[model samples]
Target: MDSEVRSYRTGGDEVVLDLTRDAADFVSGRGDGLLQVFVPHATAGIAVIETGAGSDDDLLAALGDLLPADDRWRHRHGSAGHGRSHVMPAIVPPHCTVPVLGGTLALGTWQSICLVDLNVDNAERQVRWSFLAA
Candidate 1:
């Protein structure tokens, strides 16, 4: 297995940063295997979805409706609705495994790997990428 952690600056706002390119680069020439993308944070998650077609924003909006960042949460500490960040992982999940075939990601044409960060307190995030050859 080959593994590495990469840093990303998500700023102090909620965002869905695309990571397909990075993941592809990491698995390039590595042959058939599985790529595991993990975010070691309570407030962050990894998602495989279509991007650039408002799907990203729609996801955030859906989450906002589902888990409104308000004072109703008991896990308060950071910004308003910070507690919602912790709950996001339940829906989005903190890790995802993608199949790589012939050194290429076996994802749909419109699909993309994205980092979903709802925590406004931290501007930096680390994603661990591990590849296991088949």
Candidate 2:
């Protein structure tokens, strides 16, 4: 097993960041295994979806509909509707696992790894990448 942590500045807005290239790079030449992407944050999550085809925005939109950023949350703190960010993990999850074949990511043709952040209060995010050889 091998692992490392990488940081990203998500700024003060909701974002869907593509991490496919970096994920691929990390697994490169590592042989068959499993690549686990984990975000160590209460208000963030990892998602595997199609990007650059409006899907990213669509996800955000759907989340907005499901979890409105308003004062209806009980875990109120930081920015408005911040509690929704906490609930997002339940829907999006904080980690995802991808298969590696011969050191390459075994992703679908249109699939991409993305970092989903809904918390506008935190600007810094960290993602832990772990590879376990099979």
- Report lDDT (CA) for all predictions: 0.97, 0.97
Model 2 bad stretches (over 4 Å): none
Candidate 1 colliding pairs: 69-81
Q: For model 2, state the Cα shift of residue 54 in Å.
A: 0.3
Off by over 4 Å in 1: none
TM-score of each: 0.99, 0.99
Q: Write the per-residue lDDT of candidate 1 for residues 1-134, one digit (tens) a residue.
A: 99999999999889999999999999999999999999999999999999999999999999999999899999989799999999999999999999999999999999999999999899999999999999
Q: Model 2: per-residue lDDT, tens digit, 1-134?
A: 89999999999889999999999999999999999999999999999999999999999999999999999999998999999999999999999999999999999999999999999999999999999999
